[model samples]
Target chain A: MEALFAIAIGTLTSCAVYLLLRARTYPVLLGLTLLSYAVNLFLFASGRLVMASAPLTDQGLERFPDPIPQALVLTAIVIGFGMTALMVVLALRAIHATGGDHVDGGER
Target chain B: MNHLPIVPILLPLIAGSVLLLSTKWSPNARHAFSLAAVVGQLAAASMLFVTVREGPVLVYALGGWAPPFGIVLVVDRLAAALLVLAGIVACASLLYAVARDTETSAQRFLALFQFQLLGIQGAFLTGDLFNLFVFFEVLLIASYALLLHGLTADRVKAALHVVVLNLIGSALFLLGVALIYGVAGTLNFADLARAIPALTSADAPLARTGALLLLVVFALKSALLPLGFWLPRAYGAAAAAVAALFAVLTKVGVYAVLRVYPLAFGPQAGELANVAEAWLLPLALATLAFGALGVLAARSLRIAAGWVVVYSVGSLLVAVALFTEGGYAAAIYYLVHSTLASAALFLVVDLVAGDRTSAGDRLDTADAMPHGALLGSFFFITAAAVAGLPPLSGFVGKVLILDASSGHPAAALIWSSLLGAALVVIVALSRAGSAVFWRTLSPSGGARAPRPSLAALAAPAAILGCIAALVAWGGSATAFAQAVGRDLAKPAVYVDAVLGGGHAQPDDRRRLR
Candidate 1:
């Protein structure tokens, strides 16, 4: 389970980096979204992955998952969503103004 | 509990909301409310500065919840001083925007500006790591809107880079926080400090990586050498007043470095003591040299001003990397001086550029500006101050840094680089000044340029006056900076005030479950 989780995050990050390094704005935006997904997953898994366990429990359970990472991930998701929307609008604006989609607003 | 610490954050938040809700209001009314908010913030920041100066660190718990379980706002001398600095910059920059009609030209400009302030002040005051990230997002988002406020092709391109880069920065910040929390089981800064020193061997490596990752995030924000290439172009493209407010933005990164590393990873952190010291100085020096060269190579006055800001950050971090009492003091003093001078420089650049119809801030000969004498003098004084000339606060700041570094092992290297950068900056500014002001073609067609209104001149003049005050009150200012330095050296006072022993419950997990 640990290896799978780590490998998933590693793959996502690598792909994100690749897309991010592209010259165009759309690729960069997609890369940012992927990167945010990896980050959210990493944050959630930081709590020491537990299966089918409630974050907080009143019953006398021997083990329960930590809750803060969940909260952190939730916040990251919301912020990430807002930022992605902003980037989309900004990319559209750049394309409209500069007549190109390259990050520098000039076609290579 | 004294509520002064939270006022700086709340004032802007309220003002921004008001401005956002009242879209039909007159520009005059919006400007009045926004300026009033900033002025109130200045007053509150001044009172908070007084309260924390010789007094204790003020900790304000949100909703009466204790630390380690809930978020807290901690204001020491450093945060209060920065609060005061931010307020002053916001006031001047917003005033300049009003005078230039930049704010009225864009939708929701006033609200976005206030939100930017809210984020800055909140970042300064928050005691939780996650809370800091939240404020960073707040500020970055507001800045994005503000950057594109007067939308142009140049602005859109610049905003794209700034936004994408910062989004990546945000991801890194989150990853670092997660690693730290996973290892230490806490996000509250004081609790992390308490927990880090006791981390087991296996956990130490994870914690160390987390700390270093945080350093990357901050270095990027502060525009340190390798991570800062986006700065000059971005700042150069921004509206002058937005760029000026952004002069404080880099310092936020510097402030984070100052606040976090010392408290959480100081000498007490066993293996992680002074974790950032190794990479800080060399990169800082390189950044300084890079900035100086960038200034020399810049073709436009605005870009040169941007490089000047980068140069100042380099020097400020060099002081911080020294990790001594006097070093922190010098860094604080330099922080104040550079922020004001750079912000003022941006405004002055705007004014100079506006006065020239054909030249448009390019460092080449053109028809002479109309307000040549007045604007020329402003540029000269600002350039002199930025380049560390005598009889100015920049010189005092440079001297303090030099004196503070005298005891370090790399004193020779530090001295040479600092002096070399100063000399290079002087040569560059002089060349820029001559090209813009001195070597000018006569006005074509004999059409004299119209004079700028007093309102436009007043903002930069007010900020320059503040720099002059820093020099005139050098003794007292330096004394205050040293006191702030001393306060930071001892982290126990900060931790105690935030956690206060009896208030923090160690077993928050069990209590929650």
Candidate 2:
């Protein structure tokens, strides 16, 4: 399970980095979204993986997953969503204004 | 629990919500309301500053939950001083926007402005790492909209860079936070401070990596070299008032560095002591040199001002890199001085550019602008201050920084780089000044530009007056900065106040939940 999680994060981050280095706004936006996903997953796993042990369980439960990282991941997800929406709109506007999708607003 | 610590954050949050809902109101009414809110913030910040001075650190826990578990807001002398600085800049910039009639041109300008304040002040006051990330996003989102407030081709392009870069920065911020939380088992700053020093040797490397990653995020925000290439264009493309307010934005990153590294990884931290010290000074000096070259290479006054902002950050951080009380004190004094100086420069650029028909702030000889003498005087004084000329606050700031670095091993390199940057800046600024004010071509655009209203002049003039006051009251300001430095140098008081000395009932948190 740990290996799978680490591999998933690594793949997402590598892909994100590649896309981020592209010379266009849309790709960069996608890259940012992917990076956020990787980050969110990373934050979620920071508290050590646990199964059948959710927070807010019955009072007599002997063990539970650390709840703080769950809360943090949730917050990260919300903020990431908002940021992605904002970037989508901003990229569209940039493309419209410059009549090109190049990040620098000029032909390469 | 004096509620004043939260006022700076809450006042702006309330004001922004109110302004957001008042879209149907007249511009005058919105402006008046926003101005009142900013004035209230200034008052609260001043009171908070006074209360924290020579007093215990003020801690406010949210929902009565104790630290190492719940979120906390801690205000020491450093945070209080930054709060006041943020307030002063916000007030002046808002006043400038109101007087210049720029606020009415955009939808929800007043609302966004107030939200930006909330983010800045909240970042300053929050004692939780996660909370700081949230506030950073708040400010960045608001700034994104504000940057594109008066939509232009240049602005859109600049916004794309600024937004994308910051988005990447946010991702890194999360990664760093997660790493730190995993290794340290805590997110609250004070708690983390206590948890870090006892890390096992196996965990030390991971925690150090996380700390350094966090530093990278901050450096990116602060516009340290190689990461700051986007700053000039983005800042130049922003509206005058927005740019003025942003003068302190980079300082937020510097504040985080000063707050986090010194406290968590200070002299006492085993293996990670002075984690950032080795890299900070050299990078800072490089950034200063790069900013100087940028200033000389910029094609316009606004872009030059942006580079000056970058230059000031580098200079301020050089002092901070020393990690001594004297170093922190110098950095604090210079931080206040440079924030105001750059802000005043931006406002003055707007005025000068407005007074011309076609010149439009480009650093070129053009038709003589109206009130050239008056605007020229403002530009000259501000330029002198930015270039660290004598008789202004910038000179004093540089001297203090130099004096603080006198005992460092790299004192020679620091002195040469700083002094060289100042000399280059002086030349670049003088050239810009002469191009705009001194070497004027014949009037080209037909109608003469009108003189700016006294109200418009008042804002920038008032900011300049603040700088002059820094000079006038140099003694007291230095003393205050030293006090802040002392407080920062010893984080025990700040830690205790937040984690142990607070009124929160941690045992009841579970039941409440």
Q: What are the TM-scores, per candidate, against the unseen true structure? A: 0.98, 0.97
TM-score between model 2 and native: 0.97
Q: Worst lDDT window (10 residues) for model 2 chain B?
A: B504-513
DockQ of each model vs. true complex = 0.72, 0.67
Q: Candidate 1 has what TM-score?
A: 0.98
Clashing pairs in 1: none
Mind giving the per-residue lDDT tens digits that candidate 1 earns over B1-513?
Answer: 888888999999998899889878887887888889899999999999988888588989899988878889998899999999999999999888887865433438888989999999999999989999999999999989988877889889888888988999999999999999988888888887788888888889999999999999999999998999989988998989899999999999999999988889888899888889999999999999999999999999999999999999999999999988899999999999999999999999999998888778898889878789999999999999899899999999999999999989999999999999999999999999999999988778666667887877899999999999999999999999998888778778788888886864545653443
Candidate 2 backbone collisions, by pair: none
Off by over 4 Å in 1: B102-107, B505-513
Question: Highest TM-score, which number?
Answer: 1
lDDT of 1 by residue, A1-108 (tens): 989999999999999999999979999999999999999999998888877776565487767778888889999999999999999999999999999999988777
Instruction: List ranges where model 2 is wrong by over 4 Å.
Output: A55-57, B103-107, B501-513
